[model samples]
Target: MANDTGKTTIDLGNLKAGGFIKERGKDLFTVRLRVPGGRMTVPRLKKIADVAEKFGGEFVHLSVRQSIELININFKDFDAVVAELGEGEQKVASCGARVRVPTACGGCEYNPNGLVDTQRSALEVDEKLFGTPTGHHKFKVGFAGCPFDCPKSATNDVGFQGAIWPELNKDECISCGLCAKSCAEGAITLGADGKPEFHPDACIYCGDCVKVCPTEAWKAAKKGYTVRIGGKWGRHPLVGTLFATFLPEDRVVDFITEVLAWYKEKADGAGRIRIGDIIIKEGTESLLDRLRAGFPDFVVAETIPPQAIATQVGK
Candidate 1:
């Protein structure tokens, strides 16, 4: 039903269901479109442009999470634009205490520095978990192909970064120091024995040493995701600390689902409280204990606390 002004009165339910945010003008709303992994074909982009020209102000805004927004849309044209989007295989994005659209780096597809296929990982997570309600506050997930962290995964609710622990083959060591020079974090150094030694605790798993190795000395011993949890970006930003490492890609969706379910169970009555705030209220150790009991199969790795990460970045 339309109001006397001919604009649809959007309630909270409709806002969450339709992915439309009421604009300053009561007669207009902004529609959000999901672009998973920030990957889109040219034809889809052109179709969005056409729709925006017809309904919006002939322009679309790109959001920080890689979604597209068509602003200045009148309520009268909402159905038409939604129909056009469906024809193009584009779906409206969601908000309001739910799993938001997943963001990701370019991944190994084109980025020479990437360690894993982040786009594929992101799409898999989006398919399995996007729009699942948290019932307390918004939850965000992001993927970075490597420690370069183009998407700033560390600041999201849950973040995943590609990693590969390199193992040195001493027999093939030429002592050229290429790996040491390539390592931006100074995790690799030449030992008194003239062979290269690696400090696993200091490594960011960027795979720079593997790429620069002339001989087959540095090899990937393990490759997987470095997981971070209880992070957020808002009026008060908190960088998530490392929770696990070498987490296999196949188990990522399950891990995320279980984590969200746990959060819902714990924060059911806590209105508008973020997961990070919960961690602060009850120490991280307590949460980690519960998480460990829930998923014993997940391999835990050494973690870098938020303070250490900040100190390293400052240098």
Candidate 2:
């Protein structure tokens, strides 16, 4: 983990090769502060700004998950930076293959496809999944308020979507084509009598038609967060794929925490940072087996799943 002869030294702090470390050199360690749900009150933001100005570079960089990143500091000052960041509040997970930060569409309760608030749960997940690994590359996780990737969750190493199952009310079938139009993926269709019908497989759960339905007929079958894993958007450019269908809010954090630990073991110091390569060569089941070893019920063939092709989220 450390090299004494060369400038590269083992970073006790979760300094990732591709993250703040790459931006600054090996001698300098970078720290990422987790801002749960990518949201912080004005006071927290101010505290972060203060930390960056005093300890790190003059400007603080924002991460894809809405976390805070301060770069270009020597390893000597890294601990002090962390202590300052966690001065009053507990510093959440921000680096090392753990859940990066949380994301929500900022879509409030008024969103039609939603009957729940995903932002709160997204933050909860962030708290539960906070393990930093010292292998391969840095891992990131994200969440969405709806299927719409407001912050491009699909492109992360692990991602979440506020998933809702669409339920079609056969009795209140008034198909004015409004709902169909509202859906970017054409999940809804007009029947013979202009009634609305839905294709479950085709729906991405992006909260689009909820507000458009004047009759309040479009119903969510089940509200939860969908999960995706092993994606990155840099030189490697591998978009994360949808991994799970129904992940309830209470379980999202725990499930993701499990995923990170597994990924760390698989990395094993020689694994690739981009996860698509592993999935393509070793297969998802093989990957899951390494991650979920103890649970007899944890069957990748029956438990874990393959990722679906992502499309038509924000649109």
Candidate 3:
């Protein structure tokens, strides 16, 4: 749309939906690209650099969510910019009330602390759920390969942290006390009889005991994600509460879908309420009851309330 001055009147909502963030300058936008799990190929990155120099500012902005945003792009060059990005197979990210791109840590692929393929899960989520409208507010998801939680999973609306439940086989045990020494949480202690006694309550499920056991006595009885729900980081930062334990990797998508359904239904008419706020208003038990119908085995009967943190300015 053009105005009397012959300047293009852009639809800000439409542009934002297509990842064209309006800049302070007239007719300028920032093109945000989807980089799932923060993984990118060298050639593609080079192409992005070329595109940014040609159609936008000389430098690209790396968003905190791991997206590459081409800054200071003229609205008139939108088509050209998208066309150039397409050649590199780069798609624009979405904004508004939708599922944003997923962030992840380097998972079991190379990180020694990793216990799950978080990168793969992140890519899968981006493929299946990225940009799906949340109906109320923006929803974010993050994946951490293990309890180290390098990705800060608890700050997202839905988070997944890799976990392992270990089991000890007494028959194969060498009783060297290696597992006890390896337990950083002090969940394991050498028993009076020189055997290892595990305190499940203190275990963070990092799998260090299983990894350090020389006799292969400590084995992973279960390996999956510890799910956290209703987390959000903003002015009123709310740390997500544990919702489920050892959720199967294959069932992650289904689990998210169910949670979204509950959020959508519960958050209706609330006017831009986040999932965490809805949980606060409706109570965790309400969502848990709905989730239990589909994920009875994984849903927890009790969970700690989401923590509300005080945000300080100019501190």
Best by lDDT: 3
- Model 2 deviation from native, Cα RMSD in Å: 6.9
Model 2 clash pairs are 2-10, 112-210, 165-221
Instruction: List residue ranges in candidate 1 displaced over 4 A.
Output: 1-18, 294-315
Model 1: lDDT equals: 0.82
In the range 159-210, model 2's lDDT, one tens digit per residue, is 7777677676766656667888888887887877788777766787765666
Candidates in order have lDDT scores of: 0.82, 0.62, 0.90
Evaluate residue 42 in candidate 1 and report its C-alpha lDDT on the 0 to 100 scale. 91
**Alpha-carbon TM-score of each model against the true structure:** 0.88, 0.71, 0.93
- What is residue 107's positional error in candidate 1, in angstroms? 0.8
Backbone clash numbers for all candidates listed: 0, 3, 0
Candidate 1 per-residue lDDT over residues 1-315, each given as its tens digit: 367998665344434544788899977888988888999889898988888988897678898889899999987676677787774488788878888889999999889989998899888988889888888989999999999899988888889999998999999989999999989998999999888989987898889999899997999988888888878876667788877787777878987887787688778787997777776666666556666775554536344334222333554
Model 2's lDDT to the true fold?
Answer: 0.62
**Best candidate per TM-score, number?**
3
lDDT of 2 at 291: 41
Summed over model 1, clashes come to 0
